[model samples]
Target: MPSTILRRAACLLVVLAVLAALQACSSGDSKTGAAVLNPSTLSSTIPVTRAACTPFGAAPSVVQAALDGALNPSCEPGGEKLERWADSDGTMRDACLFEPAAASTAHPLPLLIYLHPSLVGTDLSLDVTNIRSQLETADLSGDPDRPGFIMLAPYGRVGTRYYPLPDQDYSPGWDNWYRQMLPDGQERRVNGTTYAANVDAAAIDHYLQLVLAQGKVDRRRIYIMGWSNGSAMATLYALNRPQIAAAAVYSSPDPFGAFNDPCVQQPVVGKPKDDTELQLLNPQLPIYHMHNACDIAGLCPNSLQLRDSLASAGATLIDDHIIDASLKDVAQCNALCGTDPLANYAGLDAPGGYAANLPGYAIGTVNHLRWPSSRTVDLFDFLRDHPKP
Candidate 1:
């Protein structure tokens, strides 16, 4: 990497401070409260080395043991740091962890491992992204007085990416785990750093086990919500670890992978040719996939292939969440079909209904929708519906 780029990376904290100041100005309450970093800006900052992630100079074992009982699950809001692991390089890595205060020992709580989306941008850094909103709104259970939840949100990369793209370095060892294998063999780490779909998944597993050992968690209820690249990561994780309650993925690219189409210069869309391993894991694992009719990158052509493949591999229910809109701009869309063009299509399956709805004069792009309306599809309710049954 160039000296300029390294310097830029090192200046992450400065960027964070600027963002913090800007956020303070925007919120109008400069001195009070904290930053509000949702799924979009979570990638604003990140730890350079794995060791730097471990706070306080604690060893991995020490960190794990100290954090095992760090949380108290409860209906009332409460949380704590789960774990901090430092690699041998003395280069530490940090993480984002939040848990609702312990409700009661007798009433174990559910755990929701939330994965933020990826922002393919310049340098990565740990910012003053005030996570107050995340802390308050992390619980999607919909019951204010309901049992609490354990929400773990891992940071995505602004420099590299959350999931493997056509351009990033992915290890060959992850071939079976990740269906999107590159033609040029596996992806190698740059400077001993391995960033792949499984990397985040593995971290989730480690922290989840720590909480599980505490015995205050309900092993039966563990859910995951992933958007964009995070969606790909969550789906890939569920393939092997089916026991993760119910999962909801949003803004997923077409076929089996990719952020932009022609990924890595070649589009790796549709299901994998060899999914014998996925078939053995838990064919009945039903995952919910929501996307736009005309997807982004190059996933538009065979967007439904992922859903179809998952069904063939053993998913019982693949709920199709599609955002139906004309390929034209807002003006053009309204001129041809009028406002609420998709309102007429009730409970329409994405691939089919969306295709049939296109006007004869349609000309433009039709990609993924922001989200399937909660009235039509509530992913949170879906998660609650499945509890390790």
Candidate 2:
């Protein structure tokens, strides 16, 4: 009887040992499985469809067709004119196109999309040609040896109406005209001004398609620039489209929100709380942001906030400048209420000021709107230096 009892005890001990060993193995497997399922380790497999290649050197037919498509006119093509392209929603909008003087060499020319200030009274037709000429004078294309490039200035809608009198009725802001939406659903101004539909993604895509069809533009060299609200839109485009090589924004506001928004956890495209679609779409693009110290339109703080957000997302801070002093030109200074001068660091400590902040960015300040001769020169130089990574 004693021997039988001992055998039973030994058998029970062996069974318990096997169960413990199995439990240990199971725990180890679970840990390994968890490690494999880490979010960072998961690869994004979405395939991107690249636009058709347009070589630097192409037949005249291809080039002409592209020019024709981009500059399709409602009336006979005469002097430099404002033309409209329909958006996905079938809304017509305005865009200005300048064909580079016929190049002697086949060097592919860069295409620059210049966005205008939303508060400007005139459209692209009024100042686009002059602006292009100024850019050329600045030698913005990097080298005279190269083919130079084409310039396209798209008009943005006004956000508000300027009342000659302060007590007069309100006017439409630029965003309202561009988006065709009310401000937080407000009413339109008496001016009845609207943005040309061509500035939107659909219209921009069509314009790109026309460029691709021409087979002369360098797809890798497309760029964007804008001022004020237009600058904000340019940043939005760069954020949403991977094809844009680089961007230069002047006096622009933050697209998503202020710099302190906690939702902007990182700069890697999709990590931000707002505009997830935009972040996911264009993860690897460069941005150049510029702002003044005393921007009356609230552009200074907005630009700084965006710079911080972009830095947090692992974006390369290419160039940054803050102009706070009064302009030397008495007339220009007076026009800008003496805000033309670039301010010192002390001048930026006021409410919604930008001073002592941006990391890994080039900051500067100068007189206001000196055109391609001054601020634009610096901006375009930065763009030429940094291409899409």
Candidate 3:
């Protein structure tokens, strides 16, 4: 084999190994939460259809190889298949697409655009939660014609240009205007770092266009969801594209420049700052947001700011909550709380993972990092009701 191919293969393997290790450590055991719902429990079923997708642009040999192993349209029935599309700039971007077995051209299904968490790429995102299967089962339980929806979970690029924290290395994550911008509208980063612009939104738009052209999607029911960093991306996308019917997110940070800092508890402005660049958010778009009460000190308060700002802006259908810490899954929280430095400050005492009982913070496990299996049905239930008006 050529040296270049050898080098590429080596690099890919290392990256995969690191990602696998991270998943093993962070995701915890599968049985930590509620049991996954069985599709057999539902009365409806979708017939499996063989699906196929073609690559739009030429990808590096490493990415192409991964795609070969991960995406096989000919055999996959109701599973996710990876595909690469060319950006306007001709760079290849990857996304894992999921189509239910019952999806047909005659009856279009809803389209779901899921943005993954930071450092968690497209592949790991699917495994992060059983929400995907729960959603599929929920869709199947409904009308037969619209048995399931097509999901597109796109991979984010790692770069200092988009998110530049001096203490953290660049990893896969979505771009956020509030997190990256300073009070004066300049990029927030170390002085010498090379700052770049946004391509994630454009890439997402391209992905949506590709799926829409397939004629198997119902444009009116398009919805988006995100976790952590991706939540900000989902919010920004819903704001920009009125075509999006609704948005659902978990533990999202403040996207309106209010309480953007994890260490700082105060808003950047005098009050909950909503008049930033994302102030143009449409008030009519339905938004469902849920935050963990024992999350990072700033995040739960940030959720409040997000909720209040949007509500004050005349957003009619907004649902926000700060789930009590006692209601969280102790096992899952125990697995995740150790990884976050702020977990102790939240007074999380989820067996083997907390210290210091801080007053005013919730007293229990830290449910901020992991997706509790208990809420999957509720989240999808909300998305199912509100289609674009």
All candidates' TM-scores? 0.50, 0.55, 0.60
lDDT by residue (tens digit), candidate 2, 329-375 = 11111122212122212222232233232210123222223333355
lDDT of 3 by residue, 46-139 (tens): 2212122001011111122233234322212345555666543355667767877656688778888888876556556567677577544556
Off by over 4 Å in 1: 1-81, 86-93, 120-145, 156-197, 259-280, 298-303, 325-377
Best by TM-score: 3
Worst window of 10 by summed lDDT in candidate 1: 120-129
**Candidate 2 residue runs with Cα over 4 Å from true position:** 1-83, 103-105, 121-130, 135-143, 157-199, 258-268, 271-280, 326-372
* lDDT of residue 346 for candidate 2: 22
Q: Candidate 1, residues 69-97: lDDT per residue as tens digits?
A: 33212211233544564322221223455
Backbone Cα, N, C clashes tallied per candidate: 32, 29, 0
lDDT of 1 at 8: 92
What does the lDDT come to for candidate 1?
0.41
- The lowest-lDDT stretch of 10 consecutive residues in candidate 2 is 53-62
